[model samples]
Target: MRTVAGTGVAAVVFAGTLVTGSCQASEATGFGRLHPEADFLGSSVPVSERAGAVGRRTASVSAVAPDGLPGLDVSHYQKTVDWPGVAARGAKFAYMKATESTTYLDPTFATNYAGSANAGLVRGAYHFGLPDQASGAAQAEFFVANGGGWVNDGKTLPPVLDIEYNPYSTADWAGWCYNRTPAEVTAWLTDFVTTVDDRTGRWPVIYTTRGWWNHCTGGDVTVPAHSPLWISPVASDAGGPPGMPAGWSAYTFYQWAKSGTFPGDQDVFAGTAADLAAFAAGPAS
Candidate 1:
C-alpha cells in the first residue's frame, strides 16, 4: 500500500554533520508544546475555481486537486517528463532535490528546479544534513554557498532540511559528529535553520522520517518559530495525532508513500489539498 501526496525548490548542496564534528543529537534537544488547537478547515479555493475548469465539475471527479493546490515531488531529473504536462496532471507545486550533505548534492537538482518552473509549478529545494557538521555556522555557510540561488526570490517554500541516519554511513560520516546523540542532532538542525534564516530571510522547513522524529525530536527539541514540518511515515498509522511535530503543533506536509505512479515522483506527500497552499506560501518570507 503506497500512501501519497505532493512535495518543492532547486539548487542545493548537502553536507554530512555526524562526520564534521562531535555534535550529539541529545545536546541540542529541547521540548515545547505539541499539537495545534485549531481544526483542519477546508480550503478557501473552491473546486469550481480550479484552472482546468471547463464545465460544471465537482472535486471528486476533477483532475485538479479539490483545494486547487495539487503538488508533486521530483527526486530525479531524467524521470521528469514534460514539466508542463506533469503540472497539468493537476500539480500546482513541487519539491526538488537539492543537496544531500556538505560534500554532495542531488545530481538532478538543477534540471528539476527549472522544469518545475517551466511547468508553472511553484518549486522549492531541500538538503540532506550531515550529522557531523554540527556547527550551525559552518552548515549554514556551506548550504548558502551551494544552494542560495534557489531562494533568490524568497517566493517559494522554505528550503527543507532532510535529516536521516544511514547506518552504512555511520563509521565515516555519522560517528565522528560532535554530540552525535539525537539531542545534538536537534541542536545542530536548529543552528542550520538559524543560519539559513539569517542569510535568506526565510525560516526553513524540516523533513524527516518517522524513526528520526521519534528518536531525534522528542519533548526536548525546539523547532524555530513558524517552522513547518514535512514528515515521512512508512505506514498509515503515522497519520495519527501523535505523529505531528511538537513545537509547530501540526505538520504542513506528510510523505505517505515512496513508490507509485504519482504525477511526478517516485514518492508522494499525503495530506489535505490545503497543505499544498501552505507549502506555496513559503517560510514566512
Candidate 2:
C-alpha cells in the first residue's frame, strides 16, 4: 500500500486561464428541483458497516470543544496535514479536493486521504465539477482514476461534486465575465452527478454556494433522500444572512466561512464536530 505523512500534502496549480462573458448578477441564490435519478447512493451498506472493516474507528470522538465545528477542506495547495495531531487538536472530518478536470488532480489528495485515514478523521473527497467539459462522465472518470483508492475497507465519506465558480477563471475574467448562465451550469452539474453514480455505485454530495444553488438548481433537480447537502453562507459578525432556504432538511453540512485555520490546512469547511462525525459515518445503513 502507498504511504505518506498525512501532513505532507498541499494544493496544486490551477490551469489559470481566462474566459470572458458577463454573469447575471441575479443568477446567484435557491435550491433547484432535486433530480429524480439522484437516488443511487442510498443502497450502499450502512456507513458503520463500511468503517467496521477499515478498523480503528473513531468517527464519534470529539475533535474540538465547539469553537464551532471541526472540519477541513483539502485542496491542491493544502498538501500538508497533521492528521493525528489535527484530530488531537480538534479535527473530526475532512473533505479533500480530488479532481476538477480530466487533467488535474489536487496535488495533495492521495497523501492527505491516506494521512487523514491514518489519523482516524472521517474523510471524503470532492471533484470540482466543471460545466464547460463536453461530458460529465469524462470528468468523473478522471476523478476516480487520479483520486486515490480506498486504503482499507473503511469507507471514506461519499465523494462531493463541488460546483463553485472557478476562482482563477473568475479572477482572470474580471468580475464574472467568463461564466455561463445558471441554467447551463446546473445542467452540467446534474449530468456529472448522474454519470458518476452510474460508475461508482456511490451517489455524490453536492457542494454549492447559496447563489449557485438558488440560480442553478432552482427547484429543478431532484436530490436523493440520502444525499447530503453542503451549503456555504458567509454572514456578518452579527450572525448568518436572512432567509435560510426552505425544504432543505437534507442539509447535513455547510461552509460558514472562507478563512481561518482548519485541522488539515488553511481552508474552510461546513459542520461542527458532531456534524463531521455524522459526515464520516457516510449514509445511514
Candidate 3:
C-alpha cells in the first residue's frame, strides 16, 4: 500500500502493483471529487460575480467573444454532454479531459471523444497534470497510452497538457506549485512536453492561467516558444485573455467562459476555420 502525503488517502493494490487511491477512485468511478481545468483559475465562478474575488484584470466580453471558431472543453464534471446539440449550436472544436496523473482516466472520455466526432466536431484530448505525484515522463506516457495521443487526420487537434495549480493543496499536501521549487517545476514541465512531442511527433498545446504560470513556472519563457498557448482568463461580461504569459506573444486558444452557449467551458480558436483545420493537420514539415 502507498499513501499520498497529506492527502489522508492510501492506495490499495491487489496484484502488488495495481494502485487505487481516493482521488483516482473518484476520477475513475465518477464518485467523490477531483479538480477540473477551471477550478484553480476561478473560472468556475462567473466573471461578473467574481470581480472582487478574482482580484485580477478581466477582459471585455467583446474583445474576447467568439470572433474565431467557437469551441468547448469538457470533463466528467460536465457529465453526459449533448455533442450533437453542441455542434448544431456552432461549436467547431472540443477538448476533453482524457487522463489525470498516472493513475486516473476520465471515465467519460471515450464516450465524449467518440460522441463529439460523430457530431462532426473536431476534437482533442487534454491531460490534467499532477506534477507532485509522479515523474512528468510517467504521466505523459500514461496519458498517451490512454487517450492523449494525436493524429494528423485534419480533425484531431494536437494533444494538450493542462498544467495548472495543485488542486490537492490542503492541510495535508503542499501548496500551489506542488511544493516544488520553480526550477523543479520547470524541469518537470520540460520532461512532460518533451516526452509527448517525441511520442506524438507534434508539440502538445499547453493550457494554463497567467497567475499560475507566473507563480509556478517563474514565468518561464522557453516552453512557450515550442508549445502553443491555451490561455484561460476569467470571462467577463465585457476585453481579451489576460496578458500573454512569459514568451508567448499571442494565445492559440482562449477558454473564455466556464459555462455559456456551449455545455462546458466556452472557448475560441485564434483563427478561422481553415486555420483551425491547418492546425489540426499539424505544423508544416
Against the correct fold, how does model 2 do in TM-score? 0.63
- The model with the greatest TM-score is 3
- Per-prediction TM-score: 0.63, 0.63, 0.80
228-266: candidate 1 lDDT, tens digit per residue: 777543332322432554555655665433323344333
- Candidate 3: misplaced stretches above 4 Å? 1-64, 171-174, 235-238
* lDDT over C-alpha atoms for residue 229 of model 2: 68
Higher TM-score: candidate 2 or 3? Answer: 3
* Collision pairs in model 3: 59-239, 60-238, 60-239, 61-238
Better of 1 and 3 by TM-score: 3
Clashes of each: 55, 36, 4
For candidate 2, the per-residue lDDT at 86 reads 74
Runs in model 1 deviating more than 4 A are: 1-68, 148-155, 167-179, 236-242, 261-285
Q: Write the per-residue lDDT of candidate 2 for residues 1-285, one digit (tens) a residue.
A: 121234333222223321111111111111122121111111111112221221211121222222445577756454466778777866667777665554344556677778887888778777765455445776776666556222224447767876643432433222121266656655666667766666665667776544435544554445534345665442221153322332355355555443345632322335555555455554433
What is the alpha-carbon lDDT of model 2 when measured against the actual structure? 0.49
- Candidate 3 global TM-score: 0.80
lDDT of 3 by residue, 69-164 (tens): 899898877779999999999999999887777666565677888899999999999988878877899889888877788888877889898886
